[model samples]
Target: MDLPGVVGTFFAANTIKRECQLLLLLREYVTSLTMACLVEDQCHSTLCDALVQLCIEMRSLDSPPALIRTDPASGFTALCNNDLLKQHRLSVRNFLRESEHGSSKKRIDLSLADKVQLLKHLQLPGVSQASAAKKFGVSTSQVSRLVKAKQQIFDQFDTGNHNRKRQRAGKEEEVGSALFLWFQQKISQGARLSGPLLKQKATELAAAEGSEFTPSDGWLSRWKSRHNIAYKKEQGEKQNADFPAAQHWRQHIIPAILQAYNKDDIFNADETGLYYRGLPDKGHCLKGDELVGGKKAMERITTLVCANMSGTEKRPLFIIGKSRQPRCFPRDPSRLPVDYGHSKNAWMTGEWFAKWLKKWDGELRCKRRRICLLVDNCSAHPSNVALTNIELKFLPPNTTSLIQPLDMGVIKTGRVTTEAD
Candidate 1:
């Protein structure tokens, strides 16, 4: 370059590289400038800023600056004097280019121009965020963000079928397509059994595998609109007793209590854990916060409980056997910190219950009134020894939910009431 319109000191190879491409060209120009400063002779945030200014003030555009630097020196004033040069010299001097390829199997086309237009074309063709992410080797969120910026046109997930399949309660597993596929496969295989056969197979599978009892046909039909189709047995259904003392109380005692007291004096009593496992965590949990779950959730903490609204003397008692002492509190100074990691030093076992009963017995003798103890018919509470010591009462099966005062009123709850389920 020779320049008649402009005059000044030629910058030592004054060229733009790795620069902002506002004008939709000069990809190589920006790259070269950045590489010029990036390597042993390369750039930084400051150097890069200077390089951009230098690119804007070359002699060919107009009069050149006397020296290249960030400070507003003599050259800068002289360069800025040319208003035409300032407006057009380096219009595309801000864009930063990134890696040319993406992760997905989609090919990256090296268009001579920037990819914003190509992305827009793909968007107009109904490319989805996930598809665009796959094609561009970016994350789905990145594609979504790009699409939101109008850099591309992306389609959202189709939601019509999902709205159709969401039904009430445990019947949720039955997907439309999965059920259809199951029936289709069944018919295709000549397994068209009658209603009796279908019932029989379902019953057999239910007895054998619990989940398989639900005819796969309906579930497969559900898969058409959704992904999840298989049924999962609810937790602890096997161990749950068909009848609970709380149930008995709600059915018989609560009605009687309701007749006498307007449900408020139907007070119940049950001691719970001070620091049991599965307590609702206190504070907010960040993304990485997790309690290292294991076989621990099912492990019970020993807690004693009794609740009732009726006669004080006829209340049922409960003792969760699996619960043990907390690990946080260090034991006696002489012993190892983990000596009684989860021991009866805290839990009220049968012996402890007997002692506790002895104290209550003393209190009862002083008042000369027989005390009524309302309790659930749990194994530990109903043990021959635990029951013999008190005027024990039991609630009706599953009736604790409705009749339990805790459920009716919301007091300042202390911790997880590990009482019923």
Candidate 2:
């Protein structure tokens, strides 16, 4: 037989299946060796030793060798000539060296949600730890640890929708629990709260509890996240709003006014500032690139809108600008689309508001109609404006953004439309 050719075929095997097949062929050949071939000649004996060492190393690539040959002559005869067997042994050694260098283990981080899902998967009847680990891309030991803590994991999941990667609890547990209870009570009372107020309250609670807890910004943020709290922009007043008064007005005062006046005769008037020439405040740019914007335009106007309930009547817009006779106006002021007024700074003044209210009241009286005009309590709107047909009622101070009809969205919609134009 061509011994060098047989050895060459075994060395050419690349994949595991091919390598195993060749190994089996080599074993069979070793078993078929005649006593004549096993003769202890120096050259043949040297070749036999090399083949035995190569087979041991190859088998050790995956698992420990079941049995190692102390006497090479007992297992195999001389299979290949000197040069061929030497080259094959060198190739096997180099392959084993590379395999050792390339092996590495990496760690995987699993979130709480993922861990819960994995626990659920482990409850299947036919699944084993090894198979579950493979399915979840984790190790068998990790799966075992999760199984040990399955009860704790399930209990944590029931607390909230906390999908954090790691489970952690606040150091000051009593303070946090007490603070959350206080937060819930305040929210139930319809009180407006801000972050600074929450942090200050937390510090006070901690001090009362005899704990040295400092409510830093980071701690406050984490506490909020754990309790699922969010921050919203307070429209008119930050924390000074009188919720009890507003609630009382809504429950008692408002119903009396509604009963006394017709829905069509209840009017709301509000003034909003308009930056007619202002550009958008936000723009998109490539990441890591500095964004440049044009200087903001200060050209502004004050517009007053009046509308009655039942959507039956809408007065013409009253626009106040800095210039009484703006160059943009037509030669005739009456040709303008809106009622034009003027102030030194384009702001509504008490005199102008009183004049406007008197004009509206005179028109209502001529038509033999009485109306209730609801306006916010601002310095410009005098409660003493004298009118026979117009009953001026001011909203409780600092509650306009919360309860005023025009502020609910009317002014915002008008501003958006003006900007679009």
Candidate 3:
């Protein structure tokens, strides 16, 4: 018998007997032992001594010698398991083929460059099809096909679609390019694209092109990743603003006032609703049923929050609540950091805005600064209000996100900090 057949039969017998100790020892010194078996006498006796010594070592280990799991009917399958291979001093992990690709028929996805290299090896003299397949870790039949139709493969490679199996399956590059272009245009125009929205757009485009294929969710996700498109949390939606008007206000009007007043004099005021008892409905000290039935949990307070762009000044909060004197309020509301007001629905009206504006005007008169109060063009804000040393500038309609400095983050930070307290 040949040396290869003899070695193969010996390992097959050991695997059937589940001789884990012999398997471990073989893994450690298989290369050197194979050389010795071919060149020296009495190598089998030497191997038997090594296996006996390995059994003693196995007893000391916390776990039994690792064996590959298999169906009982299939008999022992693997020559040596991963655990024994890992413990070997030589670390021959790379020498062993991966278990996933052990089958010859499995299609190996390779780049055009790699295919070219494999084909070039096949072109060399004395390289048989089987040897070339082993070298490239593919089936012998695949190697034969590549050698037979080398010219066709070269043409496919040159076209840059040789490795793109999905294109052959149904997806066209032209459709993908069109979808990517639409995505880019939408993003550039400040439109937010959610997962569902992206999938919808892809389906619409496929229908319009009269193609039966609609991109699956997985395909759309992969497309985004392939194009390096990332999803981010949108702080606010960008509405179309009157660019000419906004440009004039920022470039012409705002700059013109710098000579007359300092940065501290410029203030932005905005209103926000606070759900004061907005704790998690669950996981609190109270029972879930108690929280579900509680009135305090539903209570909300509307507050006008103000901050100067220079960050040098912050106005006292003006809170609008449904009650004139809530149970939580002190006898003297004037001592609180926040100014209190009462409303039927806890909403700020134009009348309250006018009064609040006047109150700030009196405070500003004492500060002796020429005030430029920037406000949003909301219905609550009074358009015509008489004030001393106070110039009210209403931001263009729907342009609060673009112009209001407090909307940038001041009010949001204040809310979060307050909630923490």
Candidate 4:
């Protein structure tokens, strides 16, 4: 009875069998679990409680046992468009018929289903005399007589509305544009009309405009709301890499390079968007109502955060940036653009840090030796120049947050970059 395909047979016997089997398995599993709890000496407290409840049943001297209905759930029986009771009915029927050959053979034992099912298997759907006969489990002659009577009655009642699809109707090119403009006008005017009123309004308009009319009701009202376009974008999330950089930092890099420096001279540095999750990369988003509102309102407009941490002291510097997309060098020395604007900010790159190291340790004799700079293992972080002055143990392959102070809490996480990036 899987019968051709699942949806093929409107009420396929196979579908019923599957539904019954699922419920059977669920009931069996629950029973077995309850039994296990009873038989085992070390059963969990909750399982024992469930086992006790499972034994509640009514038995009589000469009748079938009745279920001791404990508490009937009281509330709305209909959940929106969902019918929980109908679903429960399938399960309930399966539960009662456990003695049947197997749960897999359950089906709707109804006249309509039987007739339709036979007709489908026989490759006949037009409901003919002979087809109906075999389909309905009746004599062929009997079906022929019933069909003939119905056909005669139908012939007498020929309605013009029957089989409209057979009409070879064509459409004009401007049909769409005209309909949209007309509907928009009606909606803007807040007009509401039905049946005769709708037809009368259309006729007057047609006469004035010297064109025919097409009036349809309930069509506009049922359309999707532009205001409720969709629920929050069910978009996919982006990932920075195969394994999080934070993982690499935690497992491979920290123990080898940064832990020793942590006892004396080590500090973490990073920057973040002024906006709260303006970039939803790798950070916790504002929950509840904050997210319920528009995403644009949370966008950081003109600010960047430069943060540094040493010992327990945390420094937060809010910097703003200009809208120009130019690459600048620390040694560019070209009198930083006067009109770069007050919002514009800058950071010294790896190459600049290297030269600064040479000046401090070689030329200027600054006594900052054996210094460890805790930074992410981004390609930008470990420059040849920076390595010459300060030792940067590249964060282990994929670790970033597990042990890295930056990903842990010191600095805010960045937006999850796409794999293509």
Candidate 5:
């Protein structure tokens, strides 16, 4: 029996149900009063007497639940600490139980064809339910259920191709088709799906179809497994808001640029923010922690990275900061890994980009080769920079995030390598 019913029965049997109820309320009230008295530093003489009387009556009862008694002598800090520990333990246990429930395996029932074969063999005069059960490697109870639903099984066999198992009553073939179509539509729009969000969308679709569809966790889990649906980390990209613009760039602009320049001479540059001294935001933490202790390293710098399509030449990083020179920098500026630039906001500006291009031009002056430099169409990128050896080509708006070779893998890999080093 459930605990509540058992507790009620015990109280009813003892003929002190009312007194037990009163005692519980009195005990709770006394505890709160004592805690309040201690906090206020007021005399709890009357409260102590009431607590003593409640305790005596509770012990005298036929059956008494365990009561936690806290006195002012224990100190308010100790009382609060005990309460915190109790709450923490309870939360941990609940989390573990939920995890176990999600991970637990349920009995997998036989498919319709298997059930039909088992029932058909049992129908043969010589075959007993036990023999059929043994042959099918199922229990006698399962065999009995098959026998009782023999007509339904036959109907399923006749209606279905018998190649696949029958879907559950509520989960029709239509529902699966609808869900698949929804997933396709979402993917086309570049929207990501979590389990809860998917469930909510499914529920909405089912409601619109005039059918009830509240899928269990197990049902969703099995459905995904059957359909080969999986969760994957999506690459972050700026949304392609104008398809025509992107198409124009890819089909016409990029082709024209490539025709004029060799792939080795093609270079792409992009900037990304970095927290040089801090750990990644995603990491392991203790259970129930909302915030981690210790001040986080908030020091940030913007790194303008440049690379070629052939992955041959990686230019020195254009490190933008609030100061002209940070203390961490080497005394000899030319010896540093990065060419330092400064802005009030520590972000790339058109002036800095022009200056960096001029510096790069100085490096390429000896080669006498005019190179195509691909950059994003950010406000910080100069539209009218006059250079002799370099030709600036700004990518179509919003397309650089994924299309640019520097943003796609080169810069990200560079950051990871630098972090590792």
Candidate 6:
């Protein structure tokens, strides 16, 4: 009448015919044993006798008799159910094997950007720590740690290294910080920065800080990745620009000019060359074959752009063409989209600049306004122009690429817009 033996036989048979009756009888026996121990203060022998009687009544009708054995050491009789004991041992072995395999697996690591995205997801309403952990395939404690370290994660976020999984601290972190500040200042002044230049600066900064740090190509690359810095191709003579002169002008000369004039009264003007009918420099061809095309059209024009510091006013573009009256021109010159002028080479000349400045000066005089005009030191832009209503300021020679607003993507944007049209 062993209960475990009777239950194991029915389970092996895969029958549910007597499951409800067995469950009800077991519940009744458990309740009676509890009440007898608590209310009647039953002795140990009385409880054992009650358990044996309950097991005998609960046994199935067709189950084989359970084996009875005596423990020789304790002199106690016990029921032996081999099938139930074997099944229990098998389940325990499987559980232990799974635990060993799961413990041997490696843990997944999240990147800084992934942590940032997790933080964003967690910030949304109605999301709990357990839910976030499940969604990101991480532990709840890991999610909690990330929430606590959110500020540090955000401070270290770099667009260039979004996929980088590890955070590392360098010996020259102080030098990098100072160099990044210098880099930002130079960029604000429109200086064209290169890798070698940055490396030299880093070395100098490290020396100033009394550190024996050598700036290598690898270090420079890591620093660039950390700060999300990139290089851009600079066209024309800007690569060999006078950055020192530009820095001097920005630090000393520009402040005085800015103090003297209001932002609305300050203006900058520059001219850019455009090949109005040029073809695209790229083409598609089959593999192992050269792309061939006809000679590109080089019909070029010069356009002048002028704007105020506050961006409150933009003058109509001044266009210069090679022909005074080209066949494409309408009968009336004033009907053109831009203010039209002409030169032999379709370029701005000293005479053309002087005339344009004088015309603008006259207009300002009529309005009773005295304005400061900033222009780069091109040969066409003269410093000796006599104007009562305009104070002409020329940028430092060879430093136009570093300090001139027109050359700093402004003209490029204009040319792109024109091409799109």
Highest TM-score scorer: 5
Stretches of candidate 4 off by over 4 Å are 1-252, 276-310, 313-320, 323-365, 386-389, 412-421
Better of 2 and 6 by lDDT: 2
Question: What digit string (tens of lDDT, one per residue) describes model 6 on residues 233-296?
Answer: 7676776789799999989988998999999998999998899888666666797998788887
Q: Arrange candidates by lDDT, descending.
A: 2, 6, 5, 3, 1, 4
Query: TM-score per candidate, in order?
Result: 0.29, 0.49, 0.51, 0.27, 0.54, 0.52
- Give the whole-model CA lDDT for all candidates, comma-separated: 0.39, 0.67, 0.61, 0.35, 0.62, 0.67
Q: Write model 5 residue lDDT over 7-121, tens digit each, in one string.
A: 2111110001241121122323222322111111111222233333444443344433332433222121112223332332210011222344767532425555566666767
- Model 3: how far residue 222 lies from native, Å: 1.4
Candidate number with the higher TM-score (3 or 5): 5
Candidate 2 ranges beyond 4 A from true positions: 1-223, 231-234, 286-288, 383-386, 416-421
Tell me how far the alpha carbon of residue 320 in candidate 3 is from the true structure, in angstroms, after superposition: 1.0
Write the residue-wise lDDT of candidate 4 on 14-49 in tens digits: 111232121101122212221111221111122223
- Which stretches of model 5 miss by more than 4 angstroms? 1-171, 189-194, 200-213, 231-235, 282-296, 419-421
Best of the two (2, 5) by TM-score:
5
Return the lDDT, model 4, position 69.
17
- RMSD of every candidate to native, in Å, equals 21.6, 25.3, 18.8, 22.1, 20.7, 26.5
Best model number under lDDT: 2
Instruction: Single out the weakest 10-residue window by summed lDDT for candidate 6.
Output: 70-79
Looking at model 4, how many pairs of residues clash? 15
lDDT of 5: 0.62
lDDT of 1 by residue, 1-421 (tens): 2422333332322333353221111112212322233321111222335445445533345533432322221122123223343354432111112121343333222111112432554547676666544433345664455556442221111222211212233243333323444555785564544544444544454555446445455543443324322233443222344445546655776566456543323445554554445434344557688654344344444444333454343323334343353354455523532112133444545455555566656765776645445555544344454433246555555554454454344211423343323
Q: Which pairs of residues collide in model 5?
A: none
Error of 5 at 375 (Å): 0.7
Q: How high is the lDDT of residue 201 in model 1? A: 46
Off by over 4 Å in 1: 1-233, 236-240, 243-249, 257-301, 305-347, 358-372, 382-391, 396-421
Residue 293 lDDT in candidate 5: 60
